[model samples]
Target: MLDANLKTQLQGYLTRLQQPIELVAALDDGAKSAEVRELLDEIVALSDKITLREDPTGSARKPSFVVQRVGQPMGIRFAGIPLGHEFTSLVLALLQAGGHPPKVDADVIEQIKALPGKYAFEVFISLSCHNCPDVVQALNLMAVLNPNVSTTMIDGALFQNEVEDRQIMGVPAVYLNGELFGQGRMTIEEIIAKLDTGAAARDAEKISAKEAFDVLVVGGGPAGSAAAIYAARKGIRTGVLAERFGGQVMDTLGIENFISVKATEGPKLAMALEEHVKEYGVDIMNLQRASALVPVDGGIEVKLENGAVVKSKTVVLATGARWRNMNVPGEAEFRTKGVAYCPHCDGPLFRGKRVAVIGGGNSGVEAAIDLAGIVAHVTLLEFDSQLRADAVLQKKLRSLPNVDIIVSAQTTEVTGTDKVNGLKYKDRVSGEEKRIELEGIFVQIGLVPNTDWLKGTVNLSPRGEIEVDAKGQTSLPGVFAAGDCTTVPYKQIIIAMGEGSKASLSAFDHLIRTSAA
Candidate 1:
């Protein structure tokens, strides 16, 4: 008896609703309700047969519910959508639903209770930000709990122009009562205090760079480049912002799978795409981050991390995914020297040398295979008992003469003074420790989306994925988001490019409607 229509609408939602078994433990065939409640009962009943996969490498993978220091997963559930002050309400809702809420003081509770039921609120966020989704969820729940609250998600990638106009440099910034409030993690009590103290609000027109434009895209990966080209070709003013000229592809060493290209390097491919976009007069801004956005009478005002500003009618967010880090000691120090994250980038440097690939997934296996062809030895380490990649890929890996797959192996330490000389590892099954000599280490552990700067601004799925409609509409009226940041399966470059194009067209439609009106 579930609403198929609602289900269809939320089909793009990143993670599934993992119902708690305890919810029914106390029911005891007593509780009752209308058909709506019956639908909930039916839904809850079906959940009995469901369980989450421990690995996300498979199709239909459940998103990580929490961000962990070791890149594992966080498991929690909120039954409603996140928007505005309603995000804050999520905590109260969860508390009522039998979850522990972030601690709050009694005085802060009184201030929240004293509020009038008529106020406006907006929160902007990013998906890569580990803490932002919860912040957005908390704010949305608060909005739901309070009738006077209204919330909107202004994605940093999609609405760069708006961000630039607000002088923002971080995620989860709350603008309330005409002042700026807190930015990072905050409890309901903390936010309530800021609200009562008349802090965390801003005035319109304070931010400069008032130049108008048609479309602004954040990120410089395939999706960002695709959006820039599509928009520019259509005679729309287009611009791109990126930390570097190229995106993740720049770090990719080799890409033989991209259509029409037999062999390619990440940097080379990024350069080619960059050249093509530039030819179309797409304005490019490198090494810049969007900070904040303030809704105005005409359009939204954007702020940047560098204290710059821009105003635009519509915005497109394309900040694609980022490489997941191996939070080891020497990993960061020797990233390019001996400790490397990308096999394609540094594989050639280790020719005739022993190398370690610190993952057993597709990319890790693929990297080992690629390195096996160049290096004298390739060691593939996996924390699990078996590799979590396609059988075909595993077969290919096993066929390689120089590649060795080490199961249940976890990297305990990376030991190197300057360049990586070797790594210390632990055998999960035997509890033995050993040092493996290697010239290079490729950390294909995982990927974290580039959304850290987006907190306090947009709606993010529990796994730090941007929430978008079927057509890629973000939570904001004149904003849209797409690519890896969005909650979609298949994180391929082509798919990201396709999503970016879709979002650009969606943003254009809104632009046209606004212009027509």
Candidate 2:
């Protein structure tokens, strides 16, 4: 249900529509369709400028709806129930169809208009992806502004077959004109460049896998870049492949713990990292994702998803990890607004405000203690009956005057309007649901390694992390693992960089010893 103030505000915005918009819902007789219909009915009833046309001719395969103005298709379509974070997508579509233009840069709009050919942008996204909305909204805006373009927003969860067909493991996996474009967060300018050049399209000379290297580094994160620089300095034929340089660090809002650098944003740091790596003689393969790694004669072979392969005498796995999400309601909706993952990156933003930290692990306790010094209050919520953090960390957390710890508390939902205002949690013992008012929620629930591709090629821990020795040596002789993807005790950027350096040096040592043999 819409709040009185919010509904009134929306009505004011809707009343100013330049034209009448029609919502043609292609729905079958199902619960999903019924739910969507009810939502649409409420929206259409808000203003006479909008109308709803229900069509029971929807394919049973997938439920969808279309928006049109003056009988002209705006190329805006929704394949699933636009709930949570996706609710914004629905509102933007309606507004665009009502003759309201998107708030994109004028220069970017001109660039989109000047695009050579018609581009069908199929942006596959997950509701929980914090970065997907921006991409989706940008592409949808391009479609609205240019009749030569069309856009479709596909919910990956609902369309599992398409996700499998495309082999999309990350969110915001975009495809342009039936070819895999790219994934993750990208600016409008970057998207335009990719669109103009058909960035993924390669020539035989570019993607023909005839090249071999002494050392190959997969991933372009802090660890991978460090490895490439170190290996290149050894005067070896080193190469690095990445879907996008910067990796998880690119998503970080602010980085203050990277040594020497007092404060910096993720994109700035990513650019600096790429520039530094480029200073070396390393062969860089940008926008490439390794799909498989196998042993070859006297070396290892790496196969990319784009049908490119490269053989290397030694390999360094620097693929980083992603933060584990809460996967609860309102969590995704307030992402980047009030729900954050990296405490060091986003904790300062909540200064002098009450915040909650989820999980009872070391990460969560550490975040709560760190935040206690800055924020007005810190509430630590743990799902387990007992805290799993180290004794020292638990002691420090308990000593904090502004920190309150709660055990056996399950976070059910993140509640807010525009921004996070509160959270809902259930007590495991008492079986009572309670609401806590807080401005922000930090999710410190461990990490998931990006080493799923190297599952059989290397030995993995029961926790799914790649097992590595102190020398950064993996189960395989020629293959080394580093960074958060490996069994590194610490998951800091500096530690990952150091591990990457060790792996590269180890690879070089292997090379020298093998040649001597």
Candidate 3:
């Protein structure tokens, strides 16, 4: 199943195996099973330390395989062809199962090994989902670290019955002990924090004891990374406090317009950004949400949700924007149960089912085009009289036979009992109400800045964006804002990077002048 170049790469990775590993497949006599067997054979051919064995009764799920040390108990399982975004997950499982050390933090490894109770994790994922790999890999790592922890990755597209029975309307839907645990992008640290209730308090204590920073950047998206790097390059003690490193960009799929880079994925770019920032002497604190900003004596104190306060001489607010919600009834209640924001991630879950795309912008039109290929039909609703998408996208959307466009339509409510069954909308021109039966609703309105936490602390525009001058200085002296959270016009990645750099320079200038006085 792997190509020549892929085989070479797989072979190189397999050479790191320090122990014997076995691929125990429980496959039935089916076409998918044959494919799985072929794949296992190809993988085993790469390394002498690897071997494949058939055990039709090993698991209840057919065409599945378990990756574990030769004499170890079952830990990681894959129920479908682990290709596409999950190919990396499969490779990592192989390497980790073969005794290759994972690159996780030493403290985290100890935490996983010390967990008392058993954890049986099952993740429902779609191949097209860019966020699924992180959850799968995290769970796999946990399973490998602790014998009490076991994980299984089930492809939602392949196992339709399980997804339907569990009412899984989203990708990366995680279940713990057969109960719904979470649904979305999650890292190892986040997962561990959820399991270990005392983790937050411990982390807060550590953060509280830290020394003050010369430059502190809030958020870890493109803008925050750039700001932190620039500040650290100036020989300043820079630190980044982020709710989640990469922010909304982690949920993004394709990125073809990111300057010199011809094409790349969001997670890939985010990884590069984190790696680049690590090259500097910047201290990064991930999974930290800023709750409030207090002006202290000669510095700003940023309060975290965990009750930890971090002090900085100069603060750069680069907290990025997030996907805007429709704010209608049933929208919040049915978030992962049918209402979704990412088409590339959840589109496969609604395959062969009718769905609705709300908005007339580029994102909405593009989502409609992408969903039309997977779903039975797509209804595109626009609040405006006409679509605001680019002409090329509009033309492509129009050409799709399964897509229906409605102009001057406003989404009112999402209707469903257990899951999403349909939606209600109003026809603006005709003054009529309409309902369409659909299994999914994709909201593509826009984005809202993450500046609500800074409401009374700094000057904010009517739209809640942080108000800043040309030099990226905010109303509060020694405080600067950039990226989508500020009043900057364009919200592109390159523009955010430039703005972040400018904000860092402005912060440094303020510090120098103030200290000289």
Candidate 4:
């Protein structure tokens, strides 16, 4: 049943429809069918532009719903009730059916249209997975725009047998033309890049810089974008080089900690970041990786992996960081098999099954708490004497009956022949070994900075973080650092952005002094 507030919100959303939408619910003698019918009824009552009809041909195994405009089929179907985070997917599909094109660029649309063959996408999803909506929306838009493409959204819980048959261990597990496409949340460009052969290399052109810039930002994450904006504001030539924009933020699920905004997802925030940076006169170089940095007489020569070279008077390193692995036996062997890093993407695959979470930091603890509701049992292991999560999160975890926390424990192995079946751990103080039988494992220890390319070119901490000062200045002059790649105490979106602005301003200060001298 829809709550009063939710009903009001749905009504408001549907009132903005540009065209009438028709929902066809296929039902059978099943509990889910009746539930879906009732929900559609409620939704249909919200606005005059929406209507619903029922079909009794659906089987008990998979009752489906098809969304269309007036009498035109949109080729968008849902094999199960689109509840939880998937509600957003249904809303977007309806909007697309109402004649609204996707928010993608025209060039991207043309690229997708240029594909030669027909493609079918089957996207597996969990209701609670925040990342699934983006994947589903991107594919749905593709299906809507192209005549040769079709898309379906499958609820992982309702169709457990199919999920197990496919060995699907993650939400947003996309299947293209009956074969595994990819998993997790990805941009529209990324999806098309995989389908279009030679697309990756062809779509990305070599970045060429003819003249030097006063400031060159090394990454396009929050910090680098902020730095680029600030540097460009100084009325000087500024450029940004990114292997891929958005960095670690692209991996985030829901972001509530970022100040000002009440709530936003990783991909959405990343889009906004790119758009905000584009607002300035900064030279944004995408899909370009900095392989080496050489300090020149008055500036640094940045060498890209594509062999392109660019000169800059100053540089800001915001290369960002990646997830740290357990490094234990079978951990790497079972990656995406039964081991996963993203809790939102793979948590549902382990529903009603046992799983273990490695590390007891904020990320690990949060993963345990989030997974506890989806998985049958959660065993959290920490190498330290106590949990490092916030007190509030720790309290919430304690209240969950299906969660177990072990401190001063060391993970020895992720045991499995084909898929993860169990984990071996050691009690550091008691010198006792223990084994916990589980179907999946989630590791969230920490992040390793992406500063391998900057090795020896600039001073780095023993931990591989770029060494920076109070003003975001690195060990070398005319160089600065920000975000997770730097020696900053805390790594947060707001903090990185603040540091980025500081570093850009510092670069401008250096240029001003140099010009005067």
Could you say which candidate leads in TM-score? 3
Tens-place lDDT digits, model 4, residues 88-191: 88888877887766777797899878878988889999887777888888888887788788888999888999998988887788998899999877767778
Question: Which residue segments of model 4 deviate by more than 4 Å?
Answer: 4-21, 46-61, 70-72, 203-206, 209-214, 253-268, 281-288, 294-312, 395-400, 430-432, 515-517
Model 3 TM-score, 2 decimals = 0.99
RMSD of each: 25.0, 13.4, 0.8, 2.9
lDDT of each: 0.62, 0.81, 0.94, 0.86
Candidate 2 residue 230 Cα shift, in angstroms, is 0.9
Please, what are the lDDT tens digits per residue for candidate 2 over residues 1-517? 5667766777877876788999878877778767778778878889898988866574343567777785787777777777655677778878887888767658678878888778888887766555677687778777877788877888776777876565454567788889878766776656886776654445223765557899999989989999999999888898988777888877765578989999986766887888899889778777677889989889998888767777899999988988888899999888755787766545545657899999999878988987898789999999999899999999999998999899999999999877889999999999999999998899998889988888888999987899998899998989998998998887888888899999999999999999899
- Writing each residue's lDDT as its tens digit, candidate 3 over 1-517 gives 9999999999999999999999999999899999999999999999999989999988898889999998997589999999999999999999998889999889999999998898999999999999999999999999999999999999999999999898999989999999999999999999999999999999999998999999999999999999999999999899999999998789788899998999999999999999999999689999999999999899999999999999999999999999999999999999999999999999999999999999999999999999999999999999999999999999999999999999999899999999999999999999999999998999999999999899999999999999999999999988998899999998888899999999999999988998899
Which candidate number maximizes lDDT?
3
Question: Against the hidden reference, what TM-scores do the models get?
Answer: 0.55, 0.56, 0.99, 0.89
Query: Given candidate 3, what's the lDDT at residue 17?
Result: 94
Over 4 Å off in model 3, which ranges? Answer: none
Clashes of 2: 0
lDDT of 3 at 101: 96
* lDDT per residue (tens digit) for residues 1-517 in model 1: 4467544433322123322322211111222213223433443344342222223232121111111112222122222122222333332333322323334435444555576655454454543333455455555445534545544444443344544566443455556644565554454544554455442222113324335768888788888888888889889778777756567775565577788889876656786988899899887765556777555677666677656676777777778787787776777766545776655434544557898998888888888888898789999999999999899999999998888889999888788764678998899999999889887788887777777666667788887887899888888787788788888778887788899888888888888888898
